[model samples]
Target: MASTTTVPALKADRPLLGIAFMLAAGLLFTLLDTAVKWLTQSYSPVQVVWARYAGHMLVLGGYLLILGWPRCREIMASVESLPGQFVRGLLLLAASTFAFLAFRELPLLQVYVINFSSPLLVTLLAIPLLSERVTAARGIAVAVGFVGVVIAVGPVDWRAQPAALLPFGMALCFALYQLATRRFGRNDHPLASLFYAGLAGALVSSLVVPFFWSPVALGDTPLFLLVGTLGAISQLGLIMAMRCAPASLVSPFLYLQIVWATVSGYLVFGDVPLLETYLGAVLIIGAGIFLATRKR
Candidate 1:
């Protein structure tokens, strides 16, 4: 009886660990974005993105090596799902590239606010792409979430600044990337997707990075490397988090990233979002949370 009781307690602990991982991942991702923004000031966003992917690959490769040759071979031998993995990687690359380009022009807080809409997009896309059934409440939640996005965009005419739409585009790409992940999850180990995500971006970027690469200042090389290292760590954190807890329970924790982004943007970039952005964020976040918790 005591052992059974202890088992339930141990099972309950998993979600807590998952939430902790999600929080850590959020902060790490925010730091990666901060570094990317800093890098973009001196290098092209393309070059910065390449560094992000290359660095991710380097770190992931080191881990696979440490896991021993058999583990490495197992990861490499998984070929049936490569196409899906490759596409997911491409979508993430596109998403990150779009956001980075917008980062060069927009405030970090605004970029985050727009990007966080991915949860809503995911909720909506699941209905059509995955054939998941969505009840009326989720439909309303989705609509309200977009209204939040509009508010986050502020009162200015959106057409006046085409660049403002970039983060939304990023959100769309990311949502699709996630959908692909869900599709691939049925047949592949999560590690396989991670390997392919890093591999896809690293290989494709290698071709173009040369054309865009500028010599880094000697002092900044560490920071450049740091960007990729943090990205890899954050991605690992996300995987661990999912393994630790239910996806529905842990996912809502991701919105915590906007809090980090807002604080970091203010301190690092001196960005102060207008009231509209804040209100929109609240709505989007509220709707997202509701969707995350509502019966799936």
Candidate 2:
């Protein structure tokens, strides 16, 4: 009986561990975004994106080399679901490009809040796209989340510049990208999808980089490399988290990234959002958590 009880307890801990991993992955990704924004002040957004993908490829390639060609080939060839993979990759590329633009124009936390709307969008999209039933709880969650977004937008000062639209576009594209990822998840190995995504992003960015390429300073090279490596690690951790838990359960944990971003923004840039921003963030997070806890 003691062994049985211990086993159940251990099983219970697994989901918590998965949540922790998801949170860490989100934090890493947020850091990567912040770093890119910093770099963009001195380099082109395309240049930073290219460096990120190039670095990702190098890290993945090194890992594959250590793991051996056979395993690498197996993973790459595991792409039985090529069409879905390609679609997901295309959507991701669009999302990444827009996100880079958003980072260039907006504060980190503001950009993050806008992007956080993706989960709610995904929830709504899943209904029509996946033909999943939308329950009352989900409807309420979605409504509340949107309300939070409205609150967050209250202090934006949009008339000063219309570039704010970039982040909203980024959010929409990212939402679609996540939806595509769900479709791909039904058929492909997570690592396999990631490998292909890295390949696609690298190739696309490489082509664009040459047109906009500016010489990098020695000091900046290390930062670029760090951004790429962290991005790769974050992707890996996100895959693991998704594999270990249901999307809904893991999805809510992403909002914790806002907490990380808030602290980082304060420390790194002396940025402080308005009270409405915090209130909105809390509402959106609470709504997401409510949705995550609802019984299907």
Candidate 3:
């Protein structure tokens, strides 16, 4: 077998820095998702999502103002693929909406376990969309991941727990979102992509929120703003991490979110995953890591 190792474009000495940033980003993402889950108890998913994007826009807008509009305009004009950028933003919006709904409807741990399936989904999708070769190890990994999902989900009495569909849908949308990010996000500036995505989300959700709008209670505003800030920070950190390291190295760290989700769910909501859930999560995360690390 040929060695598939390639020299990393980034400095070897800086791997720790990349890893640290990625871990921090993962933690922030977990916190963002957890906050959405918490707010869901008192607010509709639409309302929670709207608040998230609204806060994100306000923060980014302030940052842009500080940098000056002309600089922002120059940054925007530097992009060659506005249509691709817009599509990526649209996919992100859909993924966020579905994920918020999942958090609202399911336990945070369950929602994250399902969302973690995105890496596996990305692997499978890459075969066709990315023309990446899928080796036997990857095939086995995919099979094992699916089995883990079954074990995690356990005796899907879908008729009884129709809400289960929401997480699964969130997973699918998120997978698609990641794929879009890989495809369209390369040419775009990370900050620009973040700004556009937040703007797109805010505009789309704002239009939808009127139909489902309930007046925001006084106490929830802080939580809402925190969620958005966390969301933006997490995404920006993720982009920086990916730029610094290969996906195979960085992707495994995402499983850390599962740990955070489980602990947070227990601490916050007194929710515990069943034994099967733990087994499934272990299988899925393990298989994903194995597949991601396998020599090409």
Candidate 4:
């Protein structure tokens, strides 16, 4: 999904830089997720969603102004792409909400393990939606990836831990979100798409976050604000990473987030992953890398 065709070839000549950017993005994202998980412990998921999107909007808006606001009007013009922005935002909102809900009850490792399947889902969806052909190797990779998901989730009763399903739902929503970005966002300025993503999420979430809003204590204000800041930074890192190197190189590095998530989960929450989680992560991540690196 990160391997969009629209990324300019001229900007992607530095694979090493892209790899570094991707690593940084992954780390920032892991931290952002950890913060969201912690905040969701006290506030509603919708409120956290609001912070994520709202902060993203503020940062991106500032950066756009700093860059001389190139194509500013075209980017803000809603007539051409309002519906696409709405759908993409709603899709991501669902994904983030599900992820936060899952984080409240599940270990970060477990949530990330299931969420990592989004790329695999994207490959499968591309076959039909993008008119792309799936060779046997790619097909096998997708199948093995889902098998790993089952291994990660185990055969536990859903009633006992229904939150376990939330990550899977997040992965699905995020996969569609990626697809929408590729399809509907191919022609727009990348910054515009980023800006609208933040705006759309903020707009939709604004409708609900107010009802669930809890006033932050003065001391905790910075911590709450950090959530959104980290989100914007992570997203900017992802864009820069892609610009620095070809998608194939930069995309696989996204798997590094699982390692960060595992470490962060252990240190912050005292949550240790089961041996099976390791085995499953190995399988899922291996398949995803194989699929990601394979020639399309």
Candidate 5:
């Protein structure tokens, strides 16, 4: 009885740990967004992404250094789903590419608001991918959240800003990335998962970045480094987050990034989100809060 009770108690803490990981990921995500937005302004999105993955590789190197190559190789060999990790890494790379492209044209707050739709998209993808049950409340909340997205884009004249639609694509990629992470990340070593997250991306970018590369100004070199470090650490945090908690429970915590995005947008870019964005964000946030606070 004691062992059974202890085991269940320990198991219950995983979701909380996942939420904590999401919270940290959310903050780092905001910083990443700000950094990427800045870098993409001066560099090709592809080149900026190359710097990001380059940094990710450096950070991943440090992680492997701590573990030693033998253990790292062993973890790689022992992975139950190396292909899954590879797929997820590609998905994340695609998501980052979409985000960088969108951010070059959109404000941090607006881009993030559109990006917030990933939670809803995750909720939907969870059904088909993870086979999680969605209650009516969740379904309705998802619908309303999307309504907010439409509202945020402006009920009319949305076509005037075609760039606004880019984040919708970004959101879809990110949602799929999140779902893949949750689906396959659990039994793999965090290091292995982290390594593959940037492995394919770095390789692809290394080959292609030269065609699009521009010289980084001396003062702006740090931003290149920042995106890579933030990318690696945040990717690790997200891997741990999904491993710790269900996609449904943790995905909503991502909305917290909106607050950080808003602040960072104003502070870094002196940009304010349009009124429609606030209205749309409220609805999206409300739906998320409902899902997050509901009974288990």
Candidate 6:
């Protein structure tokens, strides 16, 4: 979403620092995805999603406690749109669910290349969902972005690897989530929104996870904790980046995750992306950056 917290902004001259944070955030998220993919091989995707949100809640809960009860209450009071938060949060959970499912069946490079189309989805969705006007440039970019998606999904057997489409579903969910944030986050503090998101994910995942629960080996417990911690830190990095620079300057760096995912996928999983994936990723990245830099 590239949303900044309503906190102190960095000096205008320091956009580089924000760019750095964006790069780091990209790497963290890639690492998080890699971790989730590994965990899903052994546990049900639902169970992995539960551990993710549950751990995030525990981490966020502890941070709130450290902030003191009164400050916590003040943060809670900052929410002007509770239902919007819930809707956005659940949408994210759905995206996360799709992420695990997609990763289980697709290569990391493939999943991320498709995921990059999310900004284009957001642009198309904004017209009806947020009632924002989309310029022709954006509309064309959206079209090109989908073209990139088609290229990325080239020649896949639907019957054999239907999960390949999961990333597209994830992108749609994320597009809706971003719209919800834009619509509802005007009056809500970024931290406040983050809290509500974690809360909603934690509460819901807790209730449903039991039915899909799998026993955790003591050694694998660290992986579960890592998923939660990485999610929190990755989000914090985004907050920091947006605080330090304009979205136009930093949002482009988010694509660097594609590079990181490629390298990580090769080194960690010995998976190499196809030539078509590279071609499609360039189109998707170009389209996303064009949309990001536009004044609209």
In lDDT terms, which candidate is top?
5
- Backbone clash pairs for candidate 1 read none
lDDT for each residue of candidate 4 in 1-296, tens digit (9 for 90 to 100): 33334322352267677678878988998999999888888878878888889888888888878767546775666334677766777887888889988888888878888887776777777666655567898789778978887787677678988787899899889777766665566455667667777788888889888898997768766767898889778765765665565443345566667799889998999988888887777878888678656765
What's the TM-score of every candidate structure?
0.87, 0.90, 0.88, 0.85, 0.92, 0.86
- Point to the candidate with the largest TM-score: 5
Candidate 2 stretches with Cα past 4 Å from truth are 1-18, 155-159
- Selected candidate, larger lDDT, 1 vs 5: 5
Residue 183, model 2: Cα distance from true site in angstroms: 1.5
- CA RMSD for every model? 6.7, 6.8, 4.5, 3.7, 5.1, 4.2
TM-score head-to-head 2 vs 5, winner? 5
* Overall lDDT per candidate, in order of appearance: 0.76, 0.76, 0.73, 0.74, 0.83, 0.76
lDDT of 3 by residue, 1-296 (tens): 01132322433424445566678987998899888998888888888888888888888888889989889997777555576566766777787888888788788888777777776776777566545567887778778988887788788777987877777777776666555554555446677877877777888889989888877778987898898788788877766665554444455567678789888999998998999988998888788678645766
- Clash pairs, model 3 backbone: none
Q: Model 2, 2-96: lDDT tens per residue? A: 01111011123256666777888888988898898889888888888888888888988888889898887888786656766776666767777
Q: Which ten residues in a row have the lowest lDDT in candidate 4?
A: 3-12
Model 5, span 1-296: residue lDDT tens = 00111111124438778889999999998999899998888889999889999999998898788988889888887566777778888888888888888899888888888788899988877877777778988899899998987787675356787777788888888898888776666767788888887997898889999899888899998888999999999988998888887788788889888789989999999998888888888998898887777754
**Candidate 6, TM-score vs. the true structure?**
0.86
lDDT of candidate 1 over 1-296, digit per residue (tens): 00111111123437678778878988998899998888888889999889899999888888888999998788667645677678878988999899889888888888888887777776666666656567898789778978888887776567887788899899889777766655543345556667888888888888998898899999889988998899788876766665565444455567777789898999999998888888888887788678656765
Query: Could you tell me the C-alpha RMSD of candidate 1 in Å?
Result: 6.7
* Candidate closer to the true structure by TM-score (higher is better), 1 or 5: 5
The TM-score-based order of candidates, best leading, equals 5, 2, 3, 1, 6, 4
